[model samples]
Target: MKNLGARTGFLITLGLVSLCLAPCQAQTQGSGTKSTTASAIFPNGEKGSAQTFTGTVWVQNLVATDSIYQLASGSVTFEPGARSFWHSHPSGQILLVTDGVGYHQLKGEPRQTIRKGDVVKCPPKIPHWHGASADSPMTHIHIVPNTEKGIVNWLQAVTDAEYHGAR
Candidate 1:
């Protein structure tokens, strides 16, 4: 029964993530007579575990690492004030911000505000943390390259003092 409760909570969180990420608008270029928008609505893969994140977070894995591709990718959405634990990738990770506002901080550096259309590069083996700001949710596409060397190294959870310290 305890396990079922936990799963239920995760499902509720997943529902919130889906609601936030499910909206998309079509844009017609030049001619109203043509449906010219080329947009893809990605599948919402899974709910992030409480072990890995605080609050509600969603991940949609789009690519799996293979001999040919050598890269793995997924889209992540953070609910307002939600954030990931301190972690690092072995071969580095790239974040393509797609919506709303967020905060990112490399270990020992100040927090930086991130917004839609921003691209953030997290250097290999460097500890960092990222999440949605207090006032807004955030969504980003994360690309991790060179998986043979390994992927992320999860560290400690970001303390409230650390998260609220964002500038």
Candidate 2:
């Protein structure tokens, strides 16, 4: 009876181990879709592993609407000295800073230093831009919506002269 119990325990442990490994395998293989070498080269968490571009880069189609209301959310990572072009939202937008330091400015207002844990609201139709400072990388989640006339209207990039002006 003791030997039988030991065998059962060993089998259970093996089963648990396999279960734990299965998810990791699935993640590495992706959602059965094509995966690039870049994903394999850098796992989820690696310093400077995120794709960096000179211009603005956003995660597309991250949000969806439900039966009741729409949900829109996206992640934007700004490299040092990178900022978005002037833009406004038809229904406004919200930002939740997730990493590093940055700045946000609304039309006709002084730039404000934004840090991790800060939540910023951009009023409807107010032109603005937010991005990493000249010396640091920044990351934030942008939440907006799909509306009748669309949520955002993007315009020209923020000029260097405009960005460096006194805050």
Candidate 3:
């Protein structure tokens, strides 16, 4: 019985030691890897062009790749009443809302309200448009993956009639 108690005590101590060291090991193990620096911060982004968006919008390009399985990512800020032209990605796109209120609508579908923490996934070649609501500005992180054939195909602008038709 004494030997069994000793064994159990030894095992408990070993477990406690492992738990204490695990986080320290994790912290130190990645020290040799390249550390992220201030260079990661991207400054002011470019203004959205009239050819691509209906109203004032700013885009900050975060990543663009030309290699296999091409990808592009950016943060887009839309002013109140601003929106993208109807468009579709050759591959697919993801929108992660970061702030404020917005709208997303697929072709032939009713506009859907989107807010912070909402994630919108648009399938390849599916026509869609997204923008800030008329009363609020909005920001979202847009990620496009598999861009080997290029990224977007812009169509007609969304008309006021369409925008107000959301139910």
Task: Give the top-scoring candidate (TM-score).
Answer: 1
Scored by lDDT, model 1 comes in at 0.84
For model 2, what is the error of residue 22's alpha carbon versus the real structure, in angstroms, after optimal superposition? 21
Each prediction's number of clashing residue pairs: 0, 0, 0
The model with the greater lDDT, 2 or 3, is 3
Q: Compose the digit string of candidate 2's lDDT tens values, residues 1-167.
A: 99999999999999999999988887766745432222232222322212323243444345554544564666676667777777898888999887667888898898888987899999889999888788765677788864654677886667776667554
Off by over 4 Å in 3: 1-44
- Global fold similarity of model 1 (TM-score): 0.75
Where model 1 places Cα greater than 4 Å from the true spot, the runs are 1-41
What does candidate 2 score on TM?
0.62
lDDT per model, in order? 0.84, 0.70, 0.84
Q: Give per-model TM-scores.
A: 0.75, 0.62, 0.72
After TM-score superposition, what is the CA distance of residue 125 in candidate 2 from its true location, in Å?
0.6
Kindly list the per-residue Cα lDDT of model 1 for residues 44-87, writing each as its tens digit.
45889999999988888989889888899998888889999999
* lDDT, residue 73, model 2: 69
